[model samples]
Target chain A: MKILVLMKMVPDIVEELEVASDGRSLDQEYLRFIVNERDEYALEQALLLKDGLGATVTVVAPDAPEVDDVLYTARAKGADRLIKVTGLPAGSGARATAAALAVTLPAIEGALPADLVLSGCQAIDDLDGFVAPLLAGALGVPYLGLVSRVSVDAAAGKAQVMKEFAGGVMGRFEVSLPALLGIQGCEKPPRYVPVAKVRAAIGAGGIEAVEASAGTAVAPVEVAALAKPEAAGHAEMLEGSAQDVAEKVADILAARGLL
Target chain B: MAGNVWIVAESWKGSISDATYEALALGRELADGLGVRLEAVLLGHGARAAAASLGRADGVLYVDHPALADGVGEETSRALAALAAARGPGLILVPTTNVSWDLLGLLPARLEAPLVNFCREAVVSGGGVEFTSLLYGGKMAATVGAGAGPVVVAVLPGVRPAEAGKGGAAPAVEEVVADFVVGGGVRWLEYEEPEAGDVDITQQDFLVAVGRGISNEANVEVAEELAAALGGAVCGSRPVIDQGWLPLVRQVGKSGATVKPRFYVAAGISGAPEHTEGMKDAELIVAVNMDPSAPIFSVAHYGIVEDATDVLEALAEAVRKRKG
Candidate 1:
């Protein structure tokens, strides 16, 4: 089985976000980029699947010199090959990315026909949480989203996916081969890849290129004008000595039945 | 006028969601911008009553049936598609929720319209709407344009406050029937409500959020104590929600309800932006963390570099003394 993990580069949220002069856009100058949080899990999940099934793992992402480190990181995590698609815009939304992939997937099929595709449920940046299904539609393959568990049967050409619903509900689904899946969490936190392995992969790079859709234009749903949220109301300092504070806290907890 | 603004009201188990009102408010804004009528297409049981209360919109069309008491994705697509054709609107808005997320992409496919998922903002331009969405994980804003046809947008819940509608008398409830079919692949097994704590934080004007810095689940007592003393609610970070320590509804973040309380105090929360965005609209932000480097301080109007357990104890005592 061959698996592909789709990754998107996003701005690091730890950094402060500056609104554009118009207050409708983000100021790019203050932006620092990293792999989207959910996409990181997607890549990690793909690598785990590769290890479990003795299959190959491939990563496809927008090509940028800055993202060379990102592709290397994927290789360190267990991807066998990395394919880069050029001319995709930075910080593009799910519709644009899915639309582009819908066009690009056919070109790469000759070298690597992906048996399965994986992505994070939602990227931390956009968090619209719709890309996985949209990509599945573009690929004309059965897909599942918000998956907590996934398994593949290479012989039967089938895959079982367990998805998450509200209030701790779980739904199980089965789909045939050449399908797409989105994963949410891990029983174990993702394994971190060492920088040394990533550097080695980059040095030995044999990167391949692919085509992407000419970008489509998006319409505004509303103009986003951001203001820093107002300050919280005054907190009355808990009075008295340390013991008094603790006692008051305990009494309050007991009254609330928290104690 | 450019086009009628349309809202797809979502329903589950025969009842509509509170976010539906937020979507209507957003739709009304779009419609007002274009100087066109704002219309809503409600699909599900009791939809007519919910539609009746939305006096803010131009009109409300209902597609009520027993089949909709349970969630029906495919049927919703048919109803929305038919409504779009009849309305001939320039833009359509739907609440971004679990059900809507499942049905969002299908609408564009069904109506042959351009669908933009999770729109954060929009502006009317040249009879079309230009929308802004945070892409690549909230790092940068991506702007897109829809062509001449209706631009369908799914909006994140809790982004805007509910507002009064300015057009056509509260929408008259009218039922529309269609050849709608529910996909049979999935069936309802059972329903169990999450174990909700005694308090609903969303209803609280005062909220005390405990972060990882709190000593342990046991130390949640200190936070809860503070909540009790102040007559507020106790909330937690993703870990608390993920651990099932609290109901999923109580979680505050990008996926959870965007909240705006009069007073929001953070104890030990390092305040990841993912977490902060949910409470950014709060009236006041008081952050108490031992680590001065914690990100919560940046957004906090008042910051105290002290342990959360200690601050919570102190604040709780102080409030109690004041009340006594």
Candidate 2:
């Protein structure tokens, strides 16, 4: 089996975000980028499939310094190949990125004959989670979102997947091979690769670059402004030690007949 | 076509969802500002009746078909794409639900139209609409707009209050029969419900909700002990449930159970919009978090800047001493 994982690099949310002076986008000078958390889960799901079915895993991501780290880490963790798409602008919308991938993925040498394509269900910055479905549409394949588990019947040429619905409902479905799935998570947490193996892989140095053509996929959405949320303006902050605050809470609960 | 706004009414189990009404309320405002007719599109088994009850729209375009009962992605996307191609509304508003993700994604790709999701507010400006949405897990807000063409938006639920439609008479209902086939390669199977938990947090009048601030599964007991002292139920945010510290049924968020308790105590939750959407309606809210800038403090009536574990133990001890 051949599986293609669409990966993304996003700004780490741990550091504070500031709106640029233009008031339409994030300030990039202080931004630090890392692999999106869900994409990590997608990589893990692909690796699990590889372990079970001896599938070959190929990863494709937009070009960034952090992308190199992710590619090296994935290689150390058993990914067979990595293709980095370059020349795309930073903070491109999901649709534009997916359009570029549609043009680039099939053209990558030895990347065709893919049996399945996997991506994270959503990214933290996109207006909506549109990449996987858009990519599926571009590829003219069936698409499913919020998938948690997947199993394949290679001989039968079909796969059974567990699709999650709202309110904790899970549905099982059988889809044809070569379909796209937007992975929410896997049964197991993403496997961890030690620093030494990643370092060695980085030193080995087999990163391939693919130049993405400028497509007609333009970002329909524009940023009018960015701002902080308004304060609630009604909270009465308690000041004191934990004990003092606890006692105060107890009194209030008692007065309200809650204790 | 260039001056009209359209709302795709969402329904479940043969009844319109609250999200549909919320979209209609916002649709009314957008329609008024643009001086255009606001039309609603309904697709289901009993869509005509549901469309009549909307009352706020100037007209309704409905497709009543048995195959549309479940709102499957492939069928619905094809049908909606055909409709949009024929009657090009300036803006299409859809509620941000599980199904909307599929429809919004496919319809835009099919038509190559601009789309946005998780929108909390929208306004007519610059010959288009400007949408305000939360980003970076609700850490910051961004306002986005599309150029003068067909744009699709999925409005977040619970962001706007539902208003009664102009309620005088039923609007014109036009039946549309599109040549879209259902059931491509995927089939709908039975839904597997989550395992039942020991306590149903929805029925409780008081709740102590723990978030990632509790740190680990072991610290969940601290929140439970505090809940026991207060004679309330224990629940948590998505991270706790995702970590297997609590059952899925005990989670409180947009994707989980929506609860309206008389009193709510939130510990360690940073108040992402997804988590707060389910519990922000509580009669009284108290928050305890080490971060003073946490968004939960904004919605909380009482705020405590301390470690949740420390606060939990102290509160439990205080309750015990008072009872003794």
Candidate 3:
């Protein structure tokens, strides 16, 4: 089985984010990029499929700063192939990214077309969480997203999938092969690759660069302004040690007759 | 140029959701700005009666079909695309919701229109709609404009109050026959609700909510002890739920359960909009996080910059001693 995972690099939220002077994008100077958390889960789900079916897993990512390290880490984690789509415009949203992949994935040299495509249900960057569906629409295939569990009925050319929805409600589905899925998570946490193994993978192989022509977002929406969420009624900060704060909390609850 | 503003009214199990109403509120504002009619496109099997609540819109384009009963991505996308193609609404505003999540990714493509997702706000400006979308999970915001063409936008909740979208004179309803054949490539089989938990967190008067900052499963017990002493319940944000540290039903978030408790103690949560949406309505909020910069502090009535587990335990002891 051939499985492909679409990956995106998002600004790590742990670091503070600043709006650029352009007021349209995040200030790049201080921005730290990492593989989107859910996409990492998507990759983990693919790795699980690889372990079960001995499937060849190919990980693909759009070009972004610090993405090569992430791709290298994926290779270290057991991905068989890495293809970075280059020459795309910066800050392309989910639609443009999906559109580019739909065109570029088929054209990667010497790699078989993926029978199953997986991506994070959504990335923190756009939070559109529509990459899987957009790619499926572009490819004219069926898609399911917010998926948590999967088992392949390779003999029947179908897969049984579990999708968790609002309130943790789940629906089991039988999706035909050659479909796309937006993976919310896997049964287990994503494996951590040590720095040494990632370095070894970097020494062992180089990523294939696939050029993508599609760059512009079809939505002509331009970021007109970017600003920190204006602080609404700011929290009245309680002073002192943990014990002091706790006493204050207890007192307030008592005053409110909540305790 | 197209002349009408439209929102895709999302429903599940025969009831309209607050997300649909929320989108209607935004739709009303956008429609008023453009001087056009606001319409709600309701799709479901036997759902015309549900259209009555969407009185904020000028009209309801009700499409009744068995295929649309479940809001399947393929069927609903095609149906909405066909409707938009026929009527050419200036803009199609969709609430970013579970029911419409699948279609939002496919609808824009089917309609051959641009899409803005994770939208917090939108307005008709300079003869076009400008959208404010939350990116980086509310860490950053982006402004986008849909230029002089039909656009599909997936709006986030809290952009407009749900109450603002509800209650007006009944609107006219127009029945539309969907034009496309329902395709089945991804088919549904069965739905499994969450296993019943020991308690319903939604009904609690006070909720001690832990977030990712609580760190691990071992820490969950600490928060539970605190909840017990405080005479409340232990709930968690999505991270804790996703980590299996807490039961799904005890989750407090947009996708889990919204709790309007009398007092809400948020520990270790960074306050993603999804998490905040559920607990923000709490009458009193106390946020405890090591990072004072956490967004939870913004909504919190009182903020404590401290380790959540430590503070929780300390608070639990304090509450017990005070009661004694």
Candidate 4:
């Protein structure tokens, strides 16, 4: 089975975000970009599948030429080949990107195409968690999101995945390829990519950039502005003794029916 | 400011959660900012009836099918995708609930929209909507924005109260009929509710909330005593919810239930965005912590820079004195 992992280069989410003077975007003066953290897990899972079943793995991402570093890392991590779509319009949102990729995927996958596609549940940056279903929809295949555990039978063309839901409940799902999966917390903790291997991948680079053909365009109603929220308000600490405070807090919780 | 606002009202068993209404309120705010009409798309059985109360949207697109009664992914996605294809909304808002989480990354890919999850606050400023999410386990806040297409965002439950219209005329509602195709290789086998007695915290009237500061499991009893004394409930942070110390429903944050209490006493919590966002709307907040720097203090109406366990015990004694 041919496995493809979709990855994107996103700004690190841990840093503080400052609005630009135009009030329309991030300041970008000191933004650090990196491969999405959860996507690394997706790559790791794809690699593990490849190692176990002797399958070919390919990594694709919609990004600029500068994202070659990501492609090289995928190759070093055991991807058979890497494809990056560069110079597609910048400032395109997820729908446009997915639409663009949907048009490109038929050709990218060809006749003997990927049997499975894996991606992180959500990029820490976009945190929208939309790519997996969009790709599967475009490709006319099945899609699963928020998968915590997965086991595949390449020969049987079936896979069992565990989904983590709120309140510690698990939803088990079975799917057949070609399918797209949006993976979140994993069965095992995400493995670390060795620094040496990353350096090596960075050095041995031969990444091909492919641009996507436009298709099925939809006109958005209006532009939405992005800005930070107003600073939080002053906390009104309820005064009293422990039991008194608890009662006060309890009264509040009870009033709200959330206690 | 580019993109029409989209609201996804989730349904299960032919009913919508209150968080869905709350998200509609947020959608109304976004629509106001964009100067576009709020559009709500309802999917599943009885979705139209459940969504009828969301009066803020300018248009209502309802898709009804029996397949959705069992949480049909294809049905839900197809319905949403079809609506999105017909009337493109720039920002899609969904309540961060179990059903929404199930859609997870899938919806964005289906609609080809960028998504933000666990968002607490969003405002239109520059040219796009910027969102603030919890960081460092809710210790801080991180704001993010997408430079391109339809943005899909999931706001944590209980982060914001559903905005109520104050004697204003209702907006016009437009319904669309579209055929959605559902044929993914997967099917829902069953929908299982968690085992009974798995959690009874939902019944607690007043909760003594704990966060990362309570490193020991035994220390939880300290909170229990305070809850007992106050005749309240014992609740926990998301970590505790994940750890089985508390039920998932009792977990406070975007992923957990949006709780509003007459009073909320947070002990040893740093008030991360996910947790704090849920409780900021509480009627009263009393934060207790050893570190004064904890963000919980910012939202607390009153606070004490002391060990929460010690303070809890002292407060319990004081309550006994005053009440007796």
| Candidate No. with top DockQ | 3
Note the residue pairs that clash in candidate 3: A221-B145, A222-B145, A223-B143
| Model 1 per-residue lDDT tens digits across residues B1-324 | 357887877765555565677777777777878888877777776557767666677877788776665544444665677777776877778876655655575566556566666566667777667776544333345565656767778776644665443234666766777555544232333444545555666678878898767757788877788888778888877656544455556767644556678778888777665577678677767777776545576667666776778778877877776567
Alpha-carbon runs more than 4 Å astray in model 3: A110-112, A127-129, A215-219
Deviation from native of the Cα of residue B79 in model 3, angstroms: 0.6
Off by over 4 Å in 4: A44-57, A61-92, A103-112, A127-129, A193-227, A236-259, B1-8, B25-42, B46-62, B80-98, B101-177, B192-251, B254-324
TM-scores for every candidate against the unseen true structure: 0.72, 0.93, 0.95, 0.66
The TM-score, computed over Cα atoms with residue i paired to residue i, of candidate 3 is 0.95
lDDT of each: 0.66, 0.81, 0.83, 0.67
Query: Residue A212: error of model 3 in Å?
Result: 2.3
The superposed Cα distance between candidate 2 and the true structure at residue B88, in angstroms, equals 1.2
What tens digits encode model 4's per-residue C-alpha lDDT throughout B120-214? 77888765677776533343355676656567787876555655411134434455665666666876655445576644554455667887677
What does candidate 2's lDDT look like per residue over B1-324, in tens digits? 265899988876567777788888898989988889999899887657887777889889998887776676666778887888888888888887665656766778877888877787888876567788877777777787777657888787775666553353788899998667676566556677887756778888989999989898888999888788778889998778767788767888755777889889999898877788788889888899888777788889899999998988998899988987
Which lDDT tens digits does candidate 2 get at residues A98-216? 88888888788888658889998887787743789888888888888778789989888888988766566677777888888888778776888999999999999898999997656
Ordered by DockQ, highest first, the candidates read: 3, 2, 4, 1
Candidates in order, interface RMSD in Å = 6.9, 2.2, 1.9, 6.0
Q: What tens-digit string does per-residue lDDT give for candidate 3 at B3-77?
A: 699899888877888888888999999899888899999988888999999999999999989888777777888
Show model 2 residue runs off by greater than 4 Å: A231-234, B46-49, B163-171, B181-183
